[model samples]
Target chain A: MGPDGSRPEPPDNPPSSEDTQRNAGARGRPGAGHILPVNRADIPFLAALGVVASVYIVLIAGIVLAKVFYVQLPLVGEVFTNPGYRYAVVLSLVSCSITTILSVWIAVPTAYLMTRVEFPGKRIVDAMLDIPIVLPPLVIGLGLLMLFQTPPGAFVQQYVTFTYAIPGVILAQFMVACAFAVRTMMAAFAEINPRQEQVAVTLGCTRAQAFWMVVLPEARRGMIPAATIAWARAMGEFGPVLVFAGTTRMRTEVMPTTIFLELQVGNLGMAAAVAAVMLALSLIVLILMRLAGHGRMF
Target chain B: MIHFDNITIRLDGFALENINLHIPTGAYAVLMGRTGCGKTTILEAACGLRPIESGRIHLMGRDVTDMPPGRRNVGLVPQDGALFTTMTVEQQLGFALRVRHRPKGEIAARARELAEWLGIGHLLHRRPHGLSGGERQRVAIGRALAAHPDILCLDEPLSALDEETHGGMLDLLRHVHEDTGVTVLHITHNRREARALAQSLIIMRGGRFLEGETARGQLAREEDDA
Candidate 1:
């Protein structure tokens, strides 16, 4: 009721199917015998959008097919048989697994703080977090190299040699991969309603208990995509690893570096074989990511 | 009793300034106000969900201004119920008890009793996503009352319900107050709700409060003036 002593108008209901058909007929267009209620005038616009989208899809499919046809099966087998290639495969998988675990650990807390807490210089901190994502990959490697030459980094290096070591490879991958994971987890946390946690706190659970029992369960859906993206990013990382870890054969030689070394030696066949392997592994991760998007992954 | 001694809270660009309110023990007090009048803000401050810039909040004669929400012994049912979607109604009802590490048998019995009392016994096994608005609110109310807190604060609990459900919920709320004798601070903009449930009424405008008989006279005069 309004102050004017009249009842306020109720909200308008959506038009029913019959009303829609009547309006279409009033517009001199047939509404029946059509699967979708699309405007005839918009067909050209829709077709143009479809054409633009299909071009990118076709280009990607064509590139993958070209690689499949170009690589000889025997060369793929021989590449796998080589000790250096085998070592690269094992190292890439192990490092990416470790990197994914580390990325999730760092991302969950960072994203939670960014989403739930208010503090001075919050905007500055948010922008700083994105620096690794936006900066050139080579610059990140160069920055890490310079840092290790300093006091703090040198102190850590004394304990474990990271420059041109396996640890350097993991560190370089983590720097870039963690950024993507943090972005995904931030979005995940933002989508959740904060009231749930508040209710938990009021129900005799401490803030930490509410987070672990209430918030974390809901945020688990985001973990799969974050982990997969970090794993794929680490698997493909090359520039930072090349600059900081210095492609030492059978040492820091991940699959990406193996491809680089093969290409450097003019062994295009072996490089294509390794590229094909990485492509297959990436496709599996992509499929899992898509499943996660549909809420199919636990 | 819930007492706010010249409370002040600042958030974003909005501020609730120098507001004072007191609801006596075991009273069903309803706070009414227009949208953005800082009614919900006052409730959050009392529950210790938001920080107070200045002044004190006393719950049952204890100053809980600096206390954490979990230790404040408040039972808050936020808008739309905000039910935990991952848990069954039974688990939600028993959440507070489980957090306190109550015995499994005791928790189960209390949950069943609450479920039966709230007319949600059939919904015990169902998760929140499958429940209706009224059912969710019932689950939320039961969850809040699980640990038997000293005060219960509800922020527009019936705003999302249909007319029939709203009436049913009003009766349930009345029964709850009568049975438990818990101090309640219910927030609503609807005058009918206040008339039906509030033993004491507080009207807020522009972050200030008008309480008790004075608030009632002011509300009538404002309506007449408008």
Candidate 2:
């Protein structure tokens, strides 16, 4: 027995020669004999498959990088100086920023409830949140357009311009970003031990205090990535913005819509330049997300 | 003082029915039972964390059944410590006082005092995640008592510790009970632990409360040790 009263475990040792070569006659290793396709013989096969998958990924990445350089290098000076493109950049930044904030506000409580509360129709509510994620963005925009024409939607639209407005861009982005936000927050809350909050309450904290102090602080590891993802999704959102919020230059035109606008004008280089900008932004967000997740790895 | 008067808690299929139990002011009592015997339910109901169907809880002479958990002023340490992993030991020990907006100086002083008393003064700045199980439990206990709660209800505080740490923690708990005169209702499945520290014991069987001879003997043994 160890000093701690734990039963002694056998020392982990290398497998004996006989143990390794039991089916040795079939396998073709240093001392093995025969071949078993499902056994050690599949090692090379798995490696080959892994190599092929990496090849495909690297090939796609290489094409993307090449296109980015090909289009962005020539147009960089022009695109950055152009006021309309700059306006698109500003519009994209503003709308996506608002969408991220709203998504977080809505996601925290919704995700918390989904994980902690057991209510009737809970599964239905959970599945409904995933609709935007599962469905196409263009379909989402179409639904929004249709809904705004309805009496209730018309009332909201009359008070607040939605269909084909800057607000519509934000609303559309929020619509899609919200699903990713909720998914991230849900996973965060689900993984956290509920006992920590329970203990906080016992320590004289009200439920809200416990949640804000204990649960929220703990969920930061998930929240940062969620926010970054929401921002990235909002920045890259195309179909919804293109359909719901028409690509009006200097107004609702965002970075994504600029890509479509340039494409329609037969300026493929400009289109790729816009895509390159998006890729840069996404890369920055992804890197920040990775760094944030790594910082929290203690 | 803590009183559970005919407490009944009914979940989907299981029910803890007609439980009547009391621990006097400043008494160190242990509630022992087999697993799933609703021992934790009584503890929860007493703290106002879990709702009771038919009973009122009177703590320190006030009928606090309708009071919210924060207002009840009962300290609870769940099994496994359940320490706030995000906070340092010092912050954890002072969490309750800080939440109540106690004076900064007073909070620091009290946290330090409790840390010293718990023999975790040196570990005050360290987070619970980095602490050993024993240290975590001590920090949890410190946090619970930081508000100077009248009744400290500990749920298997020593259950997760090794033998050496368990003995030390038991002695520490006994010291707290003796020195500070805080009421403690510790729950456990171990009879030896019940006999070691409890001034009185309540043995629960299928949600029915029974007084324990082991507890009575422990009270005598503690008296003799003192």
- Candidate with best DockQ: 1
Sort candidate 1 into its docking category.
acceptable
Q: Which candidate is the best by TM-score?
A: 1
Please report how far candidate 2 places residue B2 from its true position, in Å. Answer: 2.3
| Predictions in order: chain A TM-score | 0.85, 0.82
Per-residue CA lDDT of model 2 for A159-246, tens digit only, reads 8999899999999999999999999888877767787888788777889999999999878767776798799899989898888988
Name the candidate that leads on lDDT: 1
lDDT of 1 by residue, A143-162 (tens): 99999999999999989999
* Per-model B-chain TM-score: 0.96, 0.92
- Give a tens-digit lDDT track for model 1, residues B128-217: 764666777888999999999999999999887667677888988999999999999999987778889989999986666788898888
- Model 1 chain B weakest lDDT span, ten residues long: B127-136
TM-score of 2: 0.85
Give DockQ for candidates 1 onward, in order: 0.34, 0.23
List candidate 1 segments past 4 Å from native: A1-37, A288-298, B218-226
Error of 2 at B108 (Å): 1.1
lDDT of 2 by residue, B1-226 (tens): 9887887798888998877888989898988778888888788888887888887889999999998888888898988777776788889988998998999999999999998888788787887544566677778888899888999988888776666667777777888888879999999987668878877788765555667675465545555876
Worst 10 residues of 2 chain B by lDDT: B214-223
